[model samples]
Target chain A: MKKQIIYSLKSPYRENLDVIGFTFGSGEKSACIVGSTRGNEVQQMYICSQVVHALKKLERQGEITEGRSIMVVPCINYYSMNIGKRFWTMDNTDINRMFPGYEFGETTQRIADGVFRQVQGFKFGIQLASFYQSGDFLPHVKMMKTEFSQPEKMLEFGLPYALTRKPRPYDTTTLNYNWQIWETQAFSVYSYGTETVDEKASQVSVDAILRFLSAEGIVRANVKPGYVSRIIEENTMQQVHTEHGGIFKTLVKIGDTVYEGQVLGEVYNPLDGEKICEVKADKCGTVFFIYNKPLIMQNSVAYKIVDF
Target chain B: MIQTVAENELSVNEKLKIRKNTYQNGKGKRISIVTGTHGDELEGQFAVWLVGDYIKKNIGCLNGTVDIYPALNPLGIDSITRGIPGFDLDMNRVFPGFSEGTMAECVCNAIVEDIKGSEVCVDIHASNIYLRELPQIRISRDTAESLVPLAKMMNIDFVWVHESATVLRSTLAHSLNSIGTKTLVVELGVGMRINKDLGYQLLNGIINLLYELGMWSEKPDFEVRQPIVSFDGAVGFVNSDASGVFVSDVEFGSEVEKGDVIGRVLNPLTAESEPVKAVCSGLLFTLREYPVVYGGSLIARILSREEEN
Candidate 1:
């Protein structure tokens, strides 16, 4: 059992719209968890659940006195939290887009700077708990080609699949992608996504964290992770593009094994009821990714699968 | 006097005053028409402008008095925002507004005050433009039965009998009804563009409504027809997955059967297409013209389906 205060801080955007952060763990050593970054359901549903989880965890052990710290930002983007929206309701901006952060700026920038400063001091995991409200996104790790240290550390978290890919240069704000600046022992853990509350995903993520702590010698709990599978098969993944414009209905789920020439999805013209393209899997041993839903447009990522 | 509002405010001297045109027939009817609640939506504003021109040319030909607020959310119009500035509020939502509240509320309260005791309240709007909407009057069905017959005089194809709560919060009608005023909402075209046919059709229908309401003596040239569709059965939305450039195959205002191809998604670089089909039969009210969508983002909406009955 561990309990510590990593840092006490206020969101510069509190009076404005902002995300509220409460940290756990203590002293010089620490890890940070972006408990819930994107929120959209009944308002404060996630926050309320997280609070209950915190209370239960703290009560379970007397190892209450600790040397390491943990930061848990339960809710971000207060304005969106109120409206149950994912983006900043004020400017419709994604708060996740403004991470490591700007020192002297608006509410989001200021909050980003403060959070980054606090997290930089810790030596633990960066977990972003998110629920996909509209589209389907698979949970995976992203790293910059220069981030040699973090991706390797991601393995110990015991995720079902660990996608080691280069982070998009445009992703300057997310807490996970921001870790690339400090390569070694600094990485991210992204989870599978869905439109509504898939409690299983939440449990899976929580289980990952508990395992992560024990793996790092912080806890003495032996847990059997349900979806524990290593990505020792394939290394490189490529995005599949359609040749024309149309609606796509996918045949495979994310992370399923796929072969080249297999039917990945189907495309058609809506007005005349014509099947425009038979989107076949191109050069694949596994369907690491596929469009979560239909209504695709020209040049959209229909699938991302790789061969071992 | 001269009073400063927000940073976007025009100095009182810099403001262009709209001179009210007064008219008197043997009888009198006073009405105020409001348009452009959601900034980028401009068809209703254009209709009002066109109608305003007609009234201006024949100021003496009126059977009653009419006032027009062509663009209520001017800031929204400028930024193409769906709501007001400095607040995450919709101008249409804060009807009969609050005195001690945000800027949108203050403006809404003022509008409710101005339109007090008016014979009719017409709030005009443009659809999202992703789908073509038939010109229709949305009447509050549960309790606003009084305004429905008059709405039919507009001769639009559809009369949406949606309940007050069913509509978005803080709308003009919700405010008007709360203040004991009878209101009617008209929708046409899509946001950010001018649909000439729909615009002119709406202009004609509003004139007919005024005539039926006894605001004017001008008899409607065309007979008014109740739409074959009803409100409760007339609204459903269809969403798309893959985010990309949006391309559609259906025409606005066209009728279609179930499983029809109304639109499609395409891959830009490879020149591939993914077609979207209809799940029910009804009028294809609108279509998303621009591309770039997330899964489950709205792509089209069909009128009431039989199953909805």
Candidate 2:
């Protein structure tokens, strides 16, 4: 196991920003795993760190297969993380959206360019990503519908779901899309939390990565295959929106299975504590997404369910 | 003529009103000048003030109408914030906005709708807080075909033609172009503060553009320098190797050849200095003004006329 500085930038006030990567084995560039691109994505960073810890142990025990290498970049945007910002602190720009960045562009673009250059050339890329909105998601691997998307191989992670998403306009600059454009099959592993680390989901994410490495013959570790991941299309999910803006009280957690028309949450008027509306499930399926913020705005997505 | 484009009630005592000033003599071509899209970029506000005064003094000489929408995001400027204060959203990002959407969206929608049918639109801006920039006119590919020639008539030093596909579609100029308005974005000075000289220079550029477009009967009184017309890819970025106080050796608009040291990143703690060298021969249009910079931060942007193969 070798700890390498994948990229570094000079800072004026504090220490230089360094993107650290952990490598296991010596030869082939088998897989590259990126943790959090945003500072608020603490869960993503924690999960990647756990993966690094496990890979280090596996490498020490000679479990990592010869001539197969894997790289784990725990955190890419540490400068933002230090200040608890979701994007670049200075310009308020998102580094995640500056994929295959211009070297001479803005700060975020340069960071993306430097980081992407290091993570490219791997056979597979996995990004422990989070949603833009504050929410809890059922742990799953998401793949963009690009030319290089390998949906079948993503099931090797053994997560509950392998979601395929169609790219949006803003998604064109994302690392996941650019990774695929560069012919590296990329997958975004979303856990249950972002700002706060969820232990169970983090463990699931670490285990899933180990399971994938083992299944692909990159590592010879005896990790258990977690689940038979179901292939899900992004459009198939049912979004539940709130009708009234008020204080939200969620009754069910993410991953909870619910029957059709079941009460998922209730909104109470802030002025008087009177129940404004009840958010209900319209489909019989597992809860895929749940809004974690205390306040629910009118017409805001409160939950998403994966049809059974 | 001054009229309100958008008005939103913030409180009983205060209301946010986006105003537009029009200068007209006879109907020919309508030109719209927009600024203050981002509250922090105040250089455009000064340019608008100067241009509004110019148009007012010479209103009788104007052959067509000139519409100037200055301070588009009043709520943002009121609090000295970049985005809309409560929404914390960049008004520039929600272009061609929805009429029935949120406050920022409605504001954007109103602005887009009003400026969509203009003969030409010039969106003015200042660099963000961190950098100092030389006055330049930026146009996308589709806009370049029709606006670059007019952009050359402006007094700015650089005219950058970027690929339209690569530019963000949500920007005001992008949305205006989508609706068939030939738009040119003029960015100058720095954010939060205004350079009087650059402000007057860009103001003159707008007047010169108006004169060339036949909106003004007389030639613009300001001197116009031939601008370096370059593609977006012709700009080169110089990044810092070490994290430290960036003490620039050269100022904005400094001309440097390849391998010249533009600045040095000095580590105040270690007292070590790392020199940042220029990779291409061009004029430095952007220089980092805020000294404290992180590794990978753009220290300078050099604009050259070299065509990318």
Candidate 3:
């Protein structure tokens, strides 16, 4: 295993910001995994660290395939992470949205350009992604339904579910979308949480990545064939939005099966603690996502259920 | 007359609404003025108020319909956030939206539908708190041929014709232009605070534009400035090389020569200062407003006179 500095920038007030990558084996750049481009994605970063640890052990045991290399970047935007900010601390910009970035552009763009230049040509790309909203997602592998994307390949991760979403206009600037456009099969692994670490969910994500690597012949390890991941389209999920804004009290968690018209959560008046409304499931399905924040806004998505 | 453009029921008893005020005298060309897509950009708030006040006082000057759509993102404006408060979505980035999409998208879609078919539209904005800008109209190259003539009459200091690649396709201006609304994006001042002078300047430009578009019968009182139109590769970006509190020695919108000392990055801990110099000779149209900056923070943007020639 070799620790490589992929990109570095000299900071005036602190140590130089460095984007480090760990490489295992040599020859073909078989895969690249990135985690936590945003600061609040602690779980994403933790999952990537575990992946790196697993890869290091596999390499030491000579389990890594010959003439194949894998690169793991555990975290970017550590400067923001150190300060507990979500985006770039200097400027509130998301590095994830500056893919195929400009060399002469802003700070985030330059960092993106430097990192993309190194990670672009890999055969496969994996990103530990988190949702924009504060929520918990069922562990899954998601792929953008681009022309270059092979959704069937996502099933190889052996997670509980494999999701394919049509790319929106804002998605074109994202790293996962750009990677696929550049001909790399890209996948985003969503764990159970973003800001908080979930040990069980982290292991699920780490095991999924290793299982994929072993299945693809990049690594030779004895691992469980996790699951026959159900193929799901992103738009097909049933969303349950709260009708009132107040304190959200969730009755069901992610992965819980529910019937149509079942009460999933309740919104209570913050001041008086009176029940404002009951959030009911519109369709019978397994809960795929749940808003974890205490305060709920009117019309905010409280839960998303996927019909099996 | 005031009209609701879009509305959504909130979790509380209240409702989130986007509204427009229309002043019409007769059947003629229609012009629309829009602002407050970003809640923190308060410069536009003053312009909206001033324009509405002027139209109400001089109703006789209105030959056609003048639609003032202020606070496009009322939720953001109410919460003082750059994007939608609860959704964390940039309202400007979800343009020409889908009716079946999320709440933000539906609202954007309704706004586009409401503003479409106007002869001309002026979308006003202010720079983020970190930077201050001179009154300017930024038009993408694709729309420049048709819009530059109209932009020249808007009385701004600079008419920046940027490459289409630099323009986000999802922006309100781009969306409106793509659908043939003839929208011009006017950016000026700094975020979160109203600049009376800049606001009045923008109001004058809008009235002049209305007069030029045949939407206003009476002539505008103020003389419009013939802006310095940008040519290819005319804008020079100046970035800071050191991170510290920057103290500017030069005024914004002032002509500067190449290598002129515009600001200095002061490191109080070490008692050291790093001079930030102008990269090219031109009109300094943009300057850093916030004092603290990182190594790569943008200090200023100079519109090169030589390149324009």
Q: Pick the candidate with the highest DockQ.
A: 3
Ranked by DockQ, the better of candidates 1 and 2 is 2
Q: Pick the candidate with the highest TM-score.
A: 3
lDDT per residue, candidate 1, A12-107, as tens digits?
223333344455445645566655544453222343345336534753663323675555655554456566666654335455657776654433
Instruction: Pick out the ten consecutive residues of candidate 3 chain B with the lowest summed lDDT.
Output: B7-16
Judging by DockQ, tell me the better candidate of 2 and 3: 3
Q: After superposition, how far is residue B149 of candidate 2 from its true place, in Å?
A: 1.9
- DockQ in order: 0.02, 0.21, 0.42
lDDT, candidate 2, at B253: 86
Worst 10 residues of 3 chain A by lDDT: A100-109
In the range B129-169, model 3's lDDT, one tens digit per residue, is 89999999999999999999999999898799988753288
| Candidate achieving higher lDDT, 2 or 3 | 3
Write the residue-wise lDDT of candidate 1 on B129-155 in tens digits.
454567877776654468777677776
lDDT of 3 by residue, A4-111 (tens): 899987666878889999999999989999999999899999999998999989999999999999999988889989999888887678899888877767778888
lDDT per residue as tens, model 2, B17-72: 89998887898799999988888889988888898888888788888988999888
TM-score of each: 0.52, 0.82, 0.93
- Candidate 2 docking class: incorrect
Overlapping backbone residue pairs in candidate 2 total 8
Q: How many residue pairs clash in each candidate?
A: 56, 8, 2
